[model samples]
Target: MSKARTVRFHEYGGPEVLRLEDVEVGQPGPGEVLLRIEAIGLNRAEALFRGGHYIERARSFPARLGLEASGVVEALGDGVDGLAAGQAVSVVPSFSQNDHGVYAERAIVPASSLVPRPEGLGAVEGAAVWMPYVTAYGGLVEVGGMRAGDTVVLTGASSSVGLAAIRTAHRIGAAPLATTRTRAKRDALLKAGAAEVIVTDEEDVAERVRDLTAGRGADLVFDGVAGPGLTDLVRSVAPGGTVLLYGAVSGLPTPYPGFDLGMPAVSLRTYTMPETTRDPERLRRARAFVESGLRTGFFEPAVDRTFTLDEIVAAHRAMEAGHQVGKIVVTVPH
Candidate 1:
């Protein structure tokens, strides 16, 4: 057995509930691999899970806190093949939050969750890229039917997923129109690859979207904040457009708006990373898209901030504040 440091929460609350604790880890069991975590990515899902607002409630306390991580395979369990010790790999969004997480110095993960890090990407970028890029690729490319010359709308445009979607849209020759309620984030969003920035607090989203598309409206919308504002989204989308609703961060009602008389033939599809996670072919394509972008310098991530493992609470607090322009990452020492 060896000692591993991990971040855990005893009860659901705010970021204060997270604590760094030392624990014992045993040898990897069958189908599992022991990983020496080098870097961990912070996601809003962790904050939601910590605050007891995620779609599913935690089964118990001392719960683990993250899923995306870059680590080296330190040991392999019986029956595990195609991976060896000392190989660099990343933990994708394939683990269940109820039973496992990656916020530790060393933890056992399923071998299937491992992906070779993108060539020339460091641990921090490797950990930072997976969840957002895969989710964006899955929702935008696989599920949303994105194509060249299409117009994509992204709300919560400063979040990691939002930023990834913007880059992905631009990479595929689509016009990306992004939205933020704060005026301060507009320029940052544009610099991060958004084709147009919509200030929802000052300008009408539908009006701006109509103007940008020459009155045709957006072809696809990747929305994280789904609520009453969905009315405006419907107004901004073109006929037969697709709104890939992935998150309900607004904490408001998300009722189906089928009764709206002015509604176009928009296809409202709720999405998550599970679509790619469950399908090998989808996963293969998603990784290829991300890798191509990364190799060509089109997938450069905007890192808003970085924190140490001991400062997990502050990292969570920063994430919950909701003003970051890109990814928030936490680094782990060897």
Candidate 2:
């Protein structure tokens, strides 16, 4: 067994319960690969895991928290072919019922979860890009069925996932309209290929969306916000358009009025990115899409800030603050 630093929760509660501890990194078994994690990407899901919000939980006494990482393969277990030791790789963060946490110096991940790291991309950026890109790509291309010249409105556009949607939309020739509360991020969002950036706080989101769409509303609405924001989103989608409800940032219970369902032909559906990760063929396709975009600069991962493993608590706090522009990462010991 090898030793690694990790943040674990003894009892689910707050970030305060997250403690830095030395843990044993066991060797990979058959069809597994050992990754010497170079970086850990932080997500809101981890915070939810710490707070016991997720339905999935660890089976044993102590559970690891992180889900994605980039690293070099230290060893490969039996039956693992075509991969050797000391290869640079990116770990796919999938929905797993059983697996060790990723927020450690080393982890035993399934061979299938391993993907060749994109060339010319740094280890830290690689770790940060996978989940968000897969999430956005799957939602827009796979679920929403967006097409060229389609106007897509993405709520919470400042989120890493939202920005990924922006990039994917533009790359696919869709007109991307983004919503962010802060004015300072507008230019950055626009530069990232958002056709229009609406200040949700200052501007009437529905009105602005209509104005941008020439009063036809958006063809696709990528809404991570729920509750009242859902109502606004319903109003923002053009008739027969699709509203992909992938996340609920507002935590507001969906309040779809009686007439709401009967009034419009809009398709509102819930999407989870991890679903695509579980299907091997789909995962490969998604990875191929993102990898090609990365090589061409159509997609880029932006890290707003980084913290050491010891500062995992601060990292989670920052993510909860909702002001981070892009992904936040935890740099592991090199």
TM-score of each: 0.96, 0.95
- Candidate 2 lDDT at 282 equals 79
TM-score of 2: 0.95
Candidate 1, number of clashes = 0
Best by lDDT: 1
The 10-residue segment with the lowest total lDDT in model 1: 255-264
lDDT of 1: 0.88
RMSD of 1: 1.4
lDDT of 2 by residue, 1-334 (tens): 6788767787777777888888888889999998888998888777777777664665655666887888999999999987889888888778452365788878888888878887888888988899889998888988788899999998888888988999899889999998987797898888777888998879988889898888999999888776676777888889889888877777667777427646787777888877688877778889999999999888899788999888888888898888888899998886
lDDT of each: 0.88, 0.83
